[model samples]
Target chain A: MSEDKLLEVKNLRISFPTTRDRIEVVKGISFDLGREKLGIVGESGSGKSLTGRSILKLIRAPGQVTADKLSFKNIDLLAQNEKQMRNIRGTKISMIMQDPKFSLNPVMTIGAQISESLNAHNKLSKSEVNQRVIDMLNDVKINDPERVVKLYPHEVSGGMGQRIMIAMMLIPQPDLLIADEPTSSLDVSVQAQVLNVIDDLISKKGMGLILISHDLVLTSRYCDRILVMKSGEIVEECKASELANAKHPYTRGLLAAIPSLNETRDELPTLNRLQKEPI
Target chain B: MNAIELNELDIFYGDTQITDNISFDIKQGESFALVGESGSGKSTILKAIMGLAPKWNGSIKVNNVARSHGIDYDFAAQCQMVFQDPYGSLHPRKTVDATLSEPLTIHRISDQNERIEQVMQSVGLDLSFRFRYPHQLSGGQRQRVVIARALILEPKILLLDEPTSALDVSVQAEILNLFKKLRKERGLTYLMVTHNLPVVSFLCDRLAVIKAGKLVEVTGVEQLRQGNFKHAYTQELYAASGGVIS
Candidate 1:
């Protein structure tokens, strides 16, 4: 393993026990994360979300997560007990979910929720925590942090809500941040803004980021390295700048399927599922 | 003859105005698009045409025939809608056959089985999956079924509200191809509402950009393909979608 690696995983597998058999979702995927941006691109049911959730042991009962090696900063994650895992969850590592509408606490003020995360991870005075909350909100580019602190989640627009979610997750200053489809729900203009905030904070804080999304162009544009997943496995890994020259057929197919800005084809080329190899 | 004509349209939900003074003309067999972000009243225009938006004052015509405010049976036969979110638009308990057959039953059309099969084939859905429920199909398959349901009535004009937005990129390509084929084969007119500029460039002939309930500009798809949008908001949207401004 590299010395600068923030997180490492080897042969990670996640499964759920059904009545008849155990169905595996993440089928033996492995990767190492440095203090740089990494992107995981896959469609629905490809186990990208499952792989992210497994890092923090967020998978619930009936869903079993097993791995040959899963570690953070040379610490074995599998050996940690529930209490120890809780300590590392937000303080050392955190996750930002896809949609803010469901992730944010609707009943609580945005400021209170952000402060709660800070208080839970560290011991700080009320004023200090409040100050950090406002500062974090401002870091995410929210206008008028003082006024936004009192507003509830429902009062903010979708883009603002997502930024607030980012602020809440980022306030703890985790070593690594896993964001799942962070801006998929926002408008195009707002999506660009939210992504810029995430990009800026990731660079400024020197934090490792795992950006999980299905949009190929978006992931390629934002990440340093890209992992293309299909049927719960990584089909291709490449430098983000060379995604257009990817060698894997799946990656090429996906890129071709998306209608470009200067699309001239009478019909976009679709993936030939019938010819797809068995998982 | 124009396939669809909206003149000085005013749409409202209760007392709140959704859109005002909206006017456009889609010629016969033309594929027109309404491009805007969410809450920009693009979908409301489709709803108003479908009689879903009741509080609307406008003269809407289809094939040179004026549309009344109520649900006109004659108009219903000529126009149909394919909604966004194939997951939510479909009924969980209903089979694909049942869903497709309902429109025929409503219109009291005979030869239901034959029509259903034909429409299913037209949308490129397998006949073997006709009895499957919504949960049994993939996102792309579910969207095909939804398209089949819309086409079962043999409508002349299809009102599509973000038809491919909910599907994956590969699936979206297949669905878009299917739509193109259907329109060409059936000589159908399309009024599509979507925020995806790339999709508009692919599938539409002309597009009208809507912003906050107002039409900003109407231009040819060639302009969008060339990133030649004149309106500032349209340029912003194009740039936001990662289009290189030439």
Candidate 2:
């Protein structure tokens, strides 16, 4: 691993055991991350989420993850035991899921939940923890952190819930953040707000980010580098600025398929699956 | 005559008003859209038109005939609705063929087998999928089935409530294209509710922007393309979508 490389993955494969056969959803994908934004763009069932989850070893049994080299900061991730993995999960690399409705604990206060993330890794005093929770909430741009901290998860709106989720994930100041479709559930304006907050925090902390989303344009806009994934493989990799000129037919097809603000096409050109060649 | 008209519509759910005095019209064979954020009462407008929101106070006319506050088989034959969440809209246990045939049976239309086959083909679903249950089909395929069920009755108008929001972008494009082709071939009137602004530019002629149970702005799609919105909220929404015109 290079000195600047935060994480490195090679020949990563994730599989699930079914009744009759074993299905490999993520088949031999490889990538490296520095303190920069990397995006994995794919549609449903393209194994983008599985790859993100496999990084933290979040996938449970009946499912298996294998890799030739899975190292974070030169430490072997695949070699870590379960108890050891727990310390690395949130403190070193945290993940934010798609929906805040299901991710946040319904019964706990927002302050308590944020506090829990910090208290799990560090032994902080009561006042320090409370002040830190409020500060984190404010960092995510939540209004009136004092009042919001006392409210339950159900009381906050979807956007606020998502920001709260971000606050919880980032309070530990992880080296890498894996946000899997973080803003998909939010409205457009709120989506922009949430992404901006995340972007700001990542830059301020100088952390690596893996943004997993099905939206091509969104990924290109937010990430420094974009990886177009299809059927568990990286079909193309390029700078985000060069996504419009992506060489792969699949990438070109996806780029053309989205309706732009000034849409003039009589019909969007659908992706031709028969033309998809292995990369 | 207008294909659909709503005059001074006010919808309520047990004394809590969901939509204010909203009114709009869709001419014959016109494509119209209602766009807003979630819970802004865009979907409620579709529901009121479909008679699912029974507490509406106002007139709803389909093809110049006023609708009653109950299920009307005649109205059902002329107008049908395709809901959001294709996964939940279809019956989990029913095969695609069975789902398509039920609408025909409800309308007492004969020659059910032929109609089912034609509609399935029209929506671009393969014949092999006709026997598959909802779980057996993909999201796009299931949506195609839902659209097929809505079209099997030969309705002149369709109420699409966020039809493509649940699918992936490529799948969304395919479905949107399918909708365009269907509307052109059948000369259908559409009242689509969505929060996606670009979709309106691609698929509709005119759009009504709603906010907090009130009508914000009703403008032509050309204005939307130009980013020329009259209301401040509409401009806010346009900006929220990145305000890109190219």
TM-score of 1: 0.97
Candidates' lDDT values, in order? 0.92, 0.92
Q: Give a tens-digit lDDT track for model 1, residues A143-204.
A: 99999999999999999999999999999999999999998888788989999999999999
Clashing pairs in 2: none
Clashing pairs in 1: none
Model 2, A27-57: lDDT tens digits are 9999999999999999999999999999999
Please give, for residues B1-246, the per-residue lDDT of candidate 2 as tens digits: 699999999999899999999998999999999988888898988888888888889888889999888777888889999999998999999998889999888778899988888998899887788888989888998899999999998999999999998899999999999999999999999999988889999999999999999999999999999998879999888888879533
Best by TM-score: 1
